[model samples]
Target chain A: MPQRIGQYTVATPSRPALLSYAAAVGNKEGDGPLGSCFDYIAEDTTMGRGSWEQAESMLQKTAVQIALKKIDLAARQIDLIFAGDLLNQCIGSTFGLRDFGIPLIGLFGACSTMALSLLNAALAVDAGAARYAVAVTSSHFCSAERQFRQPLDYGGQRPPTAQWTVTGAGACVVGHGEGIAVEALTPGRVVDLGIKDANNMGAAMAPAAADTILRFLKDTGTEPGDYDRIFTGDLGVIGSRLLCELLDKEGIDLRAVHRDCGVMIFDRERQDVHAGGSGCGCSASVLCAHILPEMAAGRLKNVLFCATGALMSPTSSQQGESIPGIAHLVHLRA
Target chain B: MKPTKKEYDAMTNKASPPSPKGKNSVFAFLIGGAVCALGQALLEGYRAWGADLETAKTLVSVTFIGLTVLLTALHLYDKYAKIAGAGSLVPITGFANAMASPAIEFKTEGPVTGVGVKMFTVAGPVLVFGISASMVYGLILWVIGLFD
Candidate 1:
């Protein structure tokens, strides 16, 4: 059995950080907007399949700059890169970092991009793959929404279970640390709910979240009450309720402090956030902006972040349409 | 000698009169429009095929019911519900369309668990209320027949 770091071992080597690189590439207000930022990740209607690559690179550049500012380290000093996003070829973030010349390895896990990136970066440090490893993931809300279903201009009113996408980028650096260290890896497994209805993503995603969390608990031998907080990526209101209900049925009650980023982003009354926001960027932005700060502040010790994502393709959805959701878990010990 | 005058008078006084405020104005208008539009469309469409008035109305209602069932099964009506919004809820199609949405949602675990049983998901609740209300109405009419 892997040595689960005993109590009080984490001192937090990485500072709670925010990088300075950000560009709102889509059409929207520059201020704190209620909804997501990117109106379109990439214009697939106009830019062919190649456009996804361009959007991905842009995300990567933004991530690298922000990460660099947090560490006062130059791009040349960084040795390894673990970048991810919802798009293919890791286009948005990867292409953007190409000019920086870091040895970039691309990853994809929908909204769980950061968690996936973190697991890889942490492994690189743990296994001595490199001296310094950077983890990056980005999401463009508009691009995802348009690609998944219909164009916003088409006047599509999303269901109460539907979620809004976040248009933002986030990155983290997992280097050799004497400070707070990567504690555990609760490897995520794909649990197919077999839900064919694209309209009802809540039902599709809830069971997957339950399955991954249950597996993580079983494998790590961590009790449900072991951690103070357990977070899920984008299981907004509908998915969250179902997750609670399903897990309760399995006799695994999670934290009273359990929360989802999708439900937290907007004031539901003011923004009319329907079900909530779900996307790769939703989890990434929240983890970087909110959860990291708390971790740095020593406000939270053990956080099991499981970012949920739907893996169905547009072609798949169009043909008798089914949405197969997957969730990935990352255990960050502070 | 069944009851004293004062006792009978007290019982009658205890019964409160029903409020005369009209039912939901918006709901009434929407439902009325939906029923009339569906009824008219069916009659006109069938009249082209030389059907009588009564037969055309029945044909139209049946046609509407059939389309509703197909859309309900394929889950196409739920898609239309997104675009149509409030308008979709106005018609009989809305009720029928909502039938399989819940069933399809629960159907992922397994067929016997999700499909065979869940096929009655929303419809079960709806039919229960519908039958119960109609039974009450029928009972009132039956009691009135004795008086006649």
Candidate 2:
């Protein structure tokens, strides 16, 4: 059963387990620092698909398939699936998982989709609403570029603050079985600090991450030293630094325990990714590929996964609206 | 206390690395000059092949557009533009690429709704402003003629 903890945290007494997980990434991500941790590295960005959208769909499908195959579970055995992507209306998840015939709940948390979906799936399983649930999310560089910025072949110079959208997908299965335990969760509130630059999303999203992490630490009555690692989704270099500075103002020093998925995914100097990797896939793949596996291998005992997202559309940004950011936190135990 | 929005923006600005304007300007000047020099060479070549001055100029522009489209298709122009920056962007070749790249990207949507509709998305603004400015100049010239 799940019970409300102090303020925003929810404590799952049963601690729903993550049975299996997998990550699949494109060539660029496959060539990154954490490349070997990924379950599948597609040499072809298209995955033999005609369009980038279809390729993103294939990424999701491959991730889900690999996750299920590891646990020896069929689609019919799973009761619910929560999935999303950085595509319009989440077409990547909807179209990709359509063949599975499982009951689906579509989510749109931008880059925070992985944590959002996992939180929901864990809650559902903890409450006995489902026997097994799957959480998945994906993002593609070409698809995101076309929709948000410019055409694939457009030759506009990128600013130093701009982050490269990762081309990858990650999926995880949650059930009431022995595996990495989902102990607690904290869903973030929307925080908008009037950040208007679409290129500098790290600045936009850092405040939200700081807020959620503060609340989570306060509610849980634990210090940064309690957790082996605290993972933030796709803050890159700028946001990660800003996050530490923001938390330092409140006398909470996160410098020692903090690690960002965006910063971990790429080799900053070797890769042309200016700030680091952004997008839903960045955190999702890192969690499924690196974080969870580390926990399963007994290397990490306690971890906090906080994925942040900048919730602004192209139309809103063009209308001069500030980017609102959100971060969802999940406390996992080995 | 948490910083105000204005304060936070300032902090973010300070933390972010500034774009290398001096380096970019040097690259732009060299690349842009080279592009102009190539156009001159092509124009001279066309003239030597027995074309008039007007025909030679037209041929040079046509050749540049053709070459740009080919480079864009081969996915090589963007890599060049990454280093060349405005050097590649301020040329007629850039205008041709602006039209061609979107056409190629959006072709997945369909020929009519995708390629045709989006073909002018980037270059349309330049055409609109350029023609309007020229018209304003012509109107001013006519007013001076009337005064005379």
Candidate 3:
């Protein structure tokens, strides 16, 4: 059995190794700062596919393939796969990996799917459930827009608070070998602050991020300065600011080390991304492409990665249901 | 971790209704009025060209739709929509923009599924209700005719 640090699950006993990772993004993302770090960028959002959904599936498939190739491992060598996307029933994961024939666990944590999958993969490896596991998730802007909001051609003006869903996928392999190791896991509880505005996702998810981080610190007896960096999934500009304010109320300030994946993925000034990037791919791509590389290069030693999600559907929004948010955290040591 | 009832209430209560009423309404009025005036001008142009009232009206509608789609493709209608609000939304050009916007956006999805399927996303409901209302009105007219 793995040691429990209060409610936090310690992964030291299993020492699940994060061996390799890969990220694939769309052309718009390729124009961003971390563009060069991505393994591949599709020429267009469609990726030459018949539908945006199909293009998203291709993105996930390519990410998984590239991740496996990085470690020189075949699908057969992997014991399990954890994947998801911001599509109906997670069709992106199901259809994309269907050909691989690897036993897969489908997840739906909205934008938090990436961290959720990573945390699950690390735990599974620690529990000796699999020798090699993969965590993957994807999101496509066009597909997400059609599903969650208006279609692209609706010419609806995106409010300043609204975020652009990133079109990308990221995959990482967790195994029992030498590399960056997953240290601990903090699974967040769903928090509903009764925020009904679908456009202001950052504000909706900020309290959850703050709650999860505060809980993790409490449970582990750690301070905010323990980690070199604390990265929240896709809180964007507004959410991150709100998170700081909330944490200030809790008597802990993370302003110095806190960086959001949403804020980091795109150049806010140059890119037309209103608030910032959001979706499963936002954190997934940034972590695999930028954060992990920094760790491997010994530029960073410890990181707290927390991905937050607003668990609301179009149906829920239409029914006037408040958006519930969840944030999943993983401690990684290089 | 669960927040206390007080905490939850505080968070939810903090939500403020966000809007700049005076500015938004002004922009909407100006932009929406401009769209309607354009349609009026087009209709008058056709009438001056010696077209009948019915023909002139049809030409005006066609021209509005064509111009809306062209603006949508150029990504300018969204800017107008932002300022005009319901003003831009109330005109026939708004409906055309609604249909054309999704079609152009989904063009990369291939003509069949992408552009074809999503073409009706915004306008579908309007069309359904519109046709149904007209049918019910026609049925009433037939009933009145029989009574007469």
Best by lDDT: 2
Chain A TM-score across all models, in listed order: 0.83, 0.99, 0.98
Q: In candidate 1, which residue ranges exceed 4 Å CA deviation?
A: A1-57, B1-148
Which one is best on TM-score?
A: 2
Query: In candidate 1, what are the lDDT values of residues B45-76, reduced to their tens digit?
Result: 89988998888877876777678667756647
Index of the highest-DockQ prediction: 2
Worst 10 residues of 1 chain A by lDDT: A8-17
Answer with 2 or 3, whichever has the higher DockQ.
2
Q: All models: lDDT?
A: 0.62, 0.95, 0.88
**TM, every model:** 0.62, 0.99, 0.89
Residues A1-334 of candidate 2 have per-residue lDDT tens digits of 8999999999989889999999999999999999899999999999999999999999999999999999999999999999999999999999999999999999999999999999999999999998999999999999999999988788778999999999999999999989999999999899988999999999999999999999999998999999999999999899999999999899999988899999999998799999999999999999999999999999999999999999999999989999999999999999
DockQ of candidate 2? Answer: 0.81
lDDT of 3 by residue, B1-148 (tens): 3455467545534532345567777877888788778888988899999999999999999988888899888878877787677777888878999899888877776799978998997899999999999999999999999989
RMSD of each: 15.2, 0.9, 3.6
**Could you give the CAPRI-style class of model 2?**
high
Tens-place lDDT per residue, model 3, A1-334, is 3578886545557679899999999999999999899999999888898888999999999999999998899999999999999898999999999999899999999999998999989988988888999999999998998889875646555666788899999999999999999988888789877778899898789888998899889988888898899999999988888788778888899999999999999998799787799999999999999999999999999999999999999999989998999999999999
Going through the candidates in order, the fraction of native interface contacts each one reproduces equals: 0.07, 0.71, 0.38
Clashing pairs in 2: none
